[model samples]
Target: MKLPIHPIMEQSFAVIDREIGEHKFTSGEYAIVQRVIHTTADFEFAQLIKFSPGVIETAIAALQNKTPIITDVGMVRQGIANLVAQTFNNPIIVAVEEAPVALPGKTRTETGLLSCWRKFPEAIFVFGNAPTALLAFCEVLKNTSVKPAFAIGAPVGFISVVESKHALAKTSIPQIRVDGRKGGSPVAAAILNALIVLSC
Candidate 1:
């Protein structure tokens, strides 16, 4: 059966265009912003979402080249739209969880990220749930020669979400993410999906 939600979602873009005018975002930037707002219904992201100068261009190039994508959570992996996979043919890597986390005093997210850090240096890292994952990725990036194509650090929660995103923004790596605790799996997925649409 056809889902009625599709048309309603289509209409929301018109509403968004009307609601937000004369914005500073470039075309690709605006697309990502609009998609994030559509996914989360959060208007405040107009001010909160941040990106580097060439983030959209760099990310699009990376996607087109089939850059590997790594996620902190399964939700983010699952949320990646089919169009992105089919178009980019990218590998989606989730943080490890096959066995009990071995790192001392580390959350599963942290240890899992640690395990996969070496395997993926130039990946597009998406952290949609665990702040520790974002922090760990940043740390790993710093300690190694591996650089990411784009880092989407949108982990949600009060603990380290704000700080982690801030750190990611300051890094030399190109990044696309939001500040505060208003991000999640859907937001990360939305950013990736928007990038894919723009690239295609």
Candidate 2:
């Protein structure tokens, strides 16, 4: 189902860039911002989405080098563009759900991420569903000396998502996060896609 880009769509993107320009953002900074805003049609993201200083560059380099992109849920894994995954050999991993550790009262998302972080310490971690997944991964990083490409830590929820993101922001790990509980799998995927496209 490959479709050609329509001229009107090109104009629509131009309009988005122009509208985003009122904020006077430098091209480098807003390019990705525009992508996030474009995907969700939620202009509020322009203010809420924060990135570590070198995160974009780090993400691009990882994608260029065939690094793995790990997600907390299968939805986030599936949301990534097929072209990006195939072109870069950047395998999207979210296999823990099927055979997760049997922890009492723990979501499989939590126990699974805690275990897998040890195995793929350098992979790009994307979390769009579980706050505990982000928390668990960051906790593991606390004791180890592992370095990841970066984290797309946009877990959406009310209970502990904000706190988990706050804890993550305090770490030295490079990351991108939505400041509030208004993100989803598609948003996470769009942010990653933006990085890949900008790298081009």
Candidate 3:
């Protein structure tokens, strides 16, 4: 079945294309955006692209007249983390937005988010914080050799639906997402996954 771009998505895509092209990002970076937006929607699609460094690399390269970044954000970041570790030879970073929960083993697991991000300082910096913190991270990233790639602030439960969309909209980042008062890890992931295919 062929899926057309949602009305909102067409508007969003126009914004993305204008920003990316006007900025004159590298061909490779443009390619990454193209691939992620146009990647084949299949069983293997989930494992194919990455979020941070994988895509960020393309963004920086484009700016420098080098390669381009070509990736999008979806719900599968959790699973893709492992795939990125295995398949991606370069460094990568990821930032997650979550609230503080006072639990013994549940709070923040340094090893999981930290250990993975450390693999490629040149590649990654996974963050788990609020939207403000996330944007601050993006500002810091702007000073680096590579530009920031895809970013998602979708949080699950409670009032996160409005919060996530607001957070995402605040940035100039090309976020591929749907508009509605919905929030959940699975829902976010599923929507992102579907958009990855739909945007193509």
Clashes of each: 0, 0, 17
TM-score of each: 0.92, 0.89, 0.34
RMSD per candidate (Å) reads: 3.2, 2.8, 11.5
Model 3, span 1-200: residue lDDT tens:
34444687667556556544554434443443443343322222223223333444433332233111111122345523333333322322233222233234422322233222333323322222222333343444445564334444433334344454454455554443323342233433433333333322
Tens-place lDDT per residue, model 2, 1-200, is 23244597567678887776677555655766777787788889989888888887788788888888888899887778565654676877783573356478767888777666767889989988888888878787778787888998888879888988887898898898888888888888878877776666
Per-residue lDDT of model 1, residues 1-200, tens digit only: 12123788789988898898779899899989998999878889889888988889999899989988888888988899476556767988788552165477778877888777777778888889989878878877777666888888888889988998887877899998888888999998999888888887
Return whichever of 1 and 2 wins on lDDT: 1
lDDT of 3: 0.36
Q: List candidate 1 segments past 4 Å from native.
A: 1-6, 96-102
- Kindly indicate the candidate among 1 and 3 with the higher TM-score: 1
Rank by lDDT, highest first: 1, 2, 3
Per-candidate local distance difference test: 0.83, 0.79, 0.36
Instruction: Name model 3 segments beyond 4 Å from true.
Output: 1-77, 82-86, 89-147, 187-200
Cα error, residue 62 of model 2, in Å, equals 0.9
Give residue 169's error in model 3 in angstroms: 0.6
Which candidate wins on lDDT? 1
TM-score-based ranking, best first? 1, 2, 3
True-vs-predicted CA distance for residue 91, candidate 3, Å: 5.3
